[model samples]
Target chain A: MSRTTVVAALAAGVLLVAGCSSDEPAPAPSSSGGAATADAGQDHDYTVEGFASSVLGDGTLDDLEDVGSASGEIEGGQVEAQIVSVVADAAGTELVVVLRGDDTGSPSRWSESRGVFTDVRGVEVVDEAAGWRLQPYTILDVSGESDLGCACSEFPYRLGEDGTVVQALLPPLTEGTTSVTVALPGLEPVPGVAVTWR
Target chain B: MQTRPRRTPRWPVALLAAAALTLPTAPAHAAAAPEPGSTVDVAGVDVPVHGTFSLRAAGNASRDLVRGAVHGVRRVEGGTAVYLSLGLPASASRSLPLSSIFTRSRDYESSALAAVTLVDRPGMTAYVPLRGGDAAPYSSDVSEFRALKPGELVVLWAVFPELPAGTRTVDVLVGDARAAVTGVPVEDGALEPVADDLVPQAGEGWPKIAEGDALAGAEAPWSVRPLVQHRGSVDEVTDVAETAEEVDATLAADVLFDKSSATLTAASQDAIARLAADIAARGTGEVRVVGHTDSDGSDSSNQTLSEQRAAAVVAALQPASGTAVTFVAEGRGESEPVAPNTSPENMQLNRRVTVSYQVQEATR
Candidate 1:
């Protein structure tokens, strides 16, 4: 076969597979799409369109996967937090949470003292049943793909496609604690997000 | 609507050319001149270096003028210590304030001297000479603001931990004064002199032999407090605050734009150029330019102004060639402040722009 014929056939095969992948979620559309198609008289909630799928969950410290999610809001923008990963080391167990801000342009703010992450008032994991309130411990050590190109902060975090992913290192969950909660100061508390390892 | 012509398959030919291009190009060596002002000639002594601070001419009377020269660099335990001989020329007829040279408190972020970055790493810990040992100063103390008399040369040391091995040279910046110095061979953790001809003249009150004696010990007498540590390998060049995830940088808005205007000043453009180079060197990434303002203006006005300013910075920061990096502009107005806006100094701190980068790790 001619080279062009082979190239065309391969391209067609790839497109066929992409079109047939119904199980996979489609990529989010660009925010600029609405602006290009809008009429002068029409009003649009850019916030909702831009950031409605806001979700946050826990995952391993070294990976980005949805373990659980929590309700979060900043200003008028709704936030979703997913636990990206949980990493266990000599120090403690680190719960990596990915915080997404839909509609809020560049959700996280930068501080010289505090690295880049959202400027929410407070973030903590609560075990109300055990009467234990765990503060988020910032990860001082960063390397390889986990390093944020700026100065190192206590928390290991990276800016995502729609928001920020932060890691909180806390003491290992003790026995007898049935559930743990994740809290953002202004948003509604998300309870029972912790998973049972046993 | 226009119909596009079908393209021919050119990948076979391109792939062959790419394979040929990937052949070993050249060994890594220090570029003879990587900076515009790479050479400094003071008192007829020529030293090959790079910096923004000019040793060629006297600085303006209003600003404290500082000049630096790298004497030697040696590997110490846990870090690399760079011995710098700084001078405030007496001929300038003005005393250079010490506050501009080094901070007295541990809070390096607020120090004017914080601008001096160790180019090899993200951030550097600065030390000043004291009796029997070195003291790491912070920005919080007022007593640190001693003046530098003319013709007086003070030797200071900056230590950076875990510098990538095989790093033969590194750049040091003190305010605008920048120097790229070659590392000297170390014997017993002490720097051994290279060729005698390579040594630059140590000006009056600064004996060349005495300079090496100041840093003779294997360890500094006082415990060295590292402001920024390199947890990664030396090959990685990132911001002092940067980790594997992101890079954050703050540009004072007052230094960049005119009051209420989105236009960039010449100095701000230069600063942005440097920032762009740093971002580009990271290989590939996305840069989000965020604009912030103090609580002086109305909410709506502040928001609009902040957005416009951010857009202006983004425009300047974009690479001239391929789109390996994406730029996003955002404005927070008066919503976020690093400091309280009540005081003038604090308000000055509030008016700023932040550049954050989400870098993609290079597949090695």
Candidate 2:
């Protein structure tokens, strides 16, 4: 198993610190489930910040929770990802994740197959208490047609220097467990991510 | 060592528990915890097979795991309930088959130390989880154990067919030798809440979200844990499954075909030919070859890829089987999935190829 170094820096700004969890970094995870990290030796430099995102930001914009912004960089120019808000979804456990790829003096491009929409399935969430590590699923229609993509940002475009795509992780975690860890293929494991129940 | 205020056993549950008492060779013993700290060393991993038992018990005295912390085997409405809140030690062996008692046999994985026995009646009434519904029954929850961290705790349960009412004390046999719990109490009462983790979570009611093509489509309960039925045999060597009616062989698409490509893996013809030679002896009629893909790409793309992969397998297997079986190729696309497309293990299972031939009547 290739080791990916995680820059355990807590970034400030739009991201709010979650008071619910321990600051201790999660123990190293087993690489048994990391098929997407096929690029084993790909040198990874990323940051993981776990916090609470309290805002719904729509009609319930005024009714906000602790929805925070954090990012983990797998590659220098690839993208930055974070589990913005993890909520108790009707289906199970859901997480609103963001992947930003807008960096100056680096690659700034969105292809048809690449970027956040396609990479949504690469996000992994784990509830250690429940012994669950949920994989990404493509939500489908009743007729077994793959029309709309998963509950993620579709056809996303960058505004100025900001390139962000939000994807929802459908929950299938056990009912009793909540706090979890989030990680992309090459991303270091981020622990103490809270799950807000709806 | 604390006891939960015992609720008197229910009527039907009591009847079954009492009845089970007759099956065991030894007369029912008083509820007693298995020898605490009982452990078996398997492949250098100290697996916690033995633990405390009964809903009356609170925690296990084992060093490696805290098993059945909440509930033991209890009679529910339809069947007997087996619930466990496991707490693992820092060096606990991380394998599901080593920990949880599955309700049935699984599709793929099997360990030498697999198969936990409800060793109550010795010869007659000892039951393992039922042989599974379909597809060579396999535990769909392998990822949980593999992903287990050091000293982490996870919960698992299975509802087996009810035991006799008199079965107050029973032994939970884990692996080949070790009895996980001895003389565990079997009480009757309300069944605990079922853990919903077995079923992969989906967006409720197929609700369409967002207006874009990349939006989160609704989760339609179409695909299920694919089943294989009736008389069957599994070849762990070549990854083939056979039943009384048909001889079906499964090969992972990952091994047969590379990423997005329909071509077979380089220099892999010898393996397929070896597989063909084995199945040809009993296989008859047309060999139906089907391919499947994971839910990564778009539907149409994955469909095309699946079809191409199927055709590729057919091409490779055609000459190997000789004129005994005609190879027919088709791709069900991403439709039929053995597991949910949510995790690496499940997705790997979803991407696969199957070659089927009717079993010779004489052989059956």
Q: Write the per-residue lDDT of candidate 1 for residues B1-364, one digit (tens) a residue.
A: 1111112334532332232223222111111111222222222222222222222111121333344455444455444554445555334467666554443334232322332333332122222222222332211122433565554444444443434554444334343212122122221232322224222223211222222334343243232222222211111111123434566767878878888999998867656776787677673666888999999979999999999999998888886413678888999999999878978988987888888876555521
Candidate 2 chain B lDDT trough over 10 residues, lowest sum: B201-210
Question: How well docked is model 2, in DockQ terms?
Answer: 0.02
Tens digit per residue, CA lDDT, model 1, A1-198 = 343343234333333334453433222122221110111112211111111111100101122467577654444555566765443322223444555544323423223324244322145556454344544322231223232122111221223334333443344455555456665455576776654442
Please give the distance, in angstroms, between residue B92's alpha carbon in candidate 1 and its true position after superposition: 2.4
Tens digits of per-residue lDDT for model 2 on A60-88? 11111334444444444455554556755
In the order shown, the candidates' DockQ scores are 0.01, 0.02
What is the Cα-based lDDT of residue B276 in candidate 1? 82
- TM-score of the second chain for every model: 0.36, 0.38
List native contact recovery per candidate, as a fraction of 1: 0.01, 0.01
True contacts kept of 2: 0.01
Error of 2 at B212 (Å): 68
Model 1 Cα displacement at A70 (Å)? 50
